[model samples]
Target: MATVIHPTAIVEPGAQLGADCEIMAYAVVTKHCVLGDRVAVHPFAVIGGDPQYLKFDRASATGVTVGAGTVLREHVTINRSIYPGKATAIGENCFFMSGSHAAHDCEVGNHVVLANAALLAGHVGVGDHTFFGGGAAVHQFCRIGESVMVAGHASITRDVPHFTMVAERDDVIGFNAVGLRRRGFARAAIAELKTAFHEVYFTPGNIRDVAAARRAAGAFDSAEAKRFLDFFAGGKRGFARARRAEAEAGE
Candidate 1:
């Protein structure tokens, strides 16, 4: 399996290419950039450009690396690390759709999908199997946990927890039920998670205090419950409160 580089592509010296990798027309793979086996760079995709960090000096510019089987769509821009001589990485099997941008030092995990126009700010960390819908934007330094689904056009400024479905302005309405089911969570486990959600967000008590108490009491007794609690607890910008109708109905 020979690597394929389009005639118009510019792959700089010292940029390593793996077997079966494809660099399309007009794409640029800059110095020290490494593309793993079967990686696909679509036309106009830009990889390994210098960091956009204001504090970074040209002499200390770092590089970018893409892992095996990843696909970078047309016009996608992935920048290098801000720290001198370091590398920013995109994990294996991930998909970056057209026009998406990953800023300097961002860490994207394996199997994650970034939809068209989704943007990840510098130093953001996106966990494996997460999906960022079209036009979603993550703030700098935020952490998005594994298997989460961020709804289209949502603006995320805070950390999003694993296995959650967040939508409509910081509202974590529920667990990622479809994702959980696909990942083999049993019916009992799902039911327990639902109960935890009710208690944490829908009940009459103060959300933070109630969540803390539930955590202390070990209520629900599952890894999902703990993860949910931990996410809410660690929130610097607090989670959204349940809707008025939902809160009233839960009473």
Candidate 2:
């Protein structure tokens, strides 16, 4: 299939566009941008802009790469990485709704959805199948896990574990049960995840230490449970804590 670039759109020299890409009117794909097959850049969207860093050198030969089948809507901006040969990468089949922004050096995984006005700060890492609701904003360098749901207008300042739901101010409400179901997770797996979630969050001292101990003790059998536990192993920003009242009520 042929790629289409609107007459008014600007795809600068050195930009790489795969087949079937549609660059809408007034969209700007800079020289360092690379877009994969079937990628759609909506009107007024900008990719490969320089990083927002104060100390960034404009001469850094960085890039922004959008993977296959990704849709970047109007007014969306994905900034290039700050280091040479590095890229701000958006993975395959991801959707960024209008006005969403992904700052410099972000590593976004496949099948992610960023709703309107959702913002990912510089150097943030997001795992696959995650959903950020409208107006949600993740802090810089935070690691958000796979299949997590970040509620609308939430301010996430810490790492969120896999399959959890975060809302308001860094509050981990609970496991993302509905999302797990929609993703075709087995009932047994969901149940195991629930147990692991409770054990790790409720009985926790230092959350990372608790999760590591549980993992070492072989307390969880299911892959879902293991993944949930493993997520706590890293991230310097610390994990989002579950609300005490909600945890007490077992919500």
Candidate 3:
């Protein structure tokens, strides 16, 4: 299939576009930018522009690279690196909805979906198959794990674990049961995840205490349980704690 570029679009020299790409009107593909096969650049979307870094040097060359089959919707802005010569990348099969923004130096993984108005700060790392709901924002340098689902309007200042459903401000309500179900997780697996979830959040003891109990009680043997534990253990900004009021009310 032939690539299609609107008359009003400007694809700068040295930009590499793969087969079947479509660059819509008013879209700009800057120098050194690379777009993979079947990538779609919607109207008014800007790719491979100068980074928004304060220390950016105009003389230095840098660019953005979009992976295969990725779609950049209308009004999306993806910036390139600012540090002399570097690259900001979006992985294969990713989708950025309208008005979404991916700042410089960020790495987005395969099959990730950023809903409309979702914003990623500079240097953030989004894991594969993750889904960010509309208006969700991740702080700079935050790491989001695979298969995670962030609720709409959620503000994440820290790392989010794999397969978790996080919502509200500073709280992880529960596992992503619905997401897992849709992804074909078995009933036994969901049951194990539920048990691990209770141990991690609803237990009477601290996180460490609950983790230790899980290990001793054979809960850590399951793959899902292991992921849950390892995620919290590796947390830098610390995972959200269960609400004290809810815990007390349950008691």
Which candidate number has the best TM-score? Answer: 2
Please write out the lDDT profile of model 2 over residues 7-64, one tens digit for every residue: 9999999999999999999999999999999999999999999899999999989999
C-alpha lDDT of residue 88 in model 2: 98
Candidate order by lDDT, highest to lowest? 2, 1, 3
In TM-score terms, candidate 1 sits at 0.86
**Which is the better candidate, 1 or 2, if ranked by lDDT?**
2
Report the lDDT tens digits of candidate 3 across residue range 1-251.
79999999989989999999999999989885999999999999999888888888877888788999999999999999776668898999999999999999999999999999999999888888889999999888787887788889889887776667666664565567777788788888777876677767777866766776676667555687777666666545656555645433322
Model 3 deviation from native, Cα RMSD in Å: 3.3
Off by over 4 Å in 1: 203-213, 232-251
TM-score of each model, in listed order: 0.86, 0.97, 0.85
With candidate 1 superimposed using the best TM-score fit, by how many Å does residue 40's alpha carbon deviate from the native? Answer: 0.5
Error of 2 at 113 (Å): 0.6
| Candidate 3 to truth, TM | 0.85
Number of clashes recorded per candidate: 0, 0, 0
Model 3 pairs in collision: none
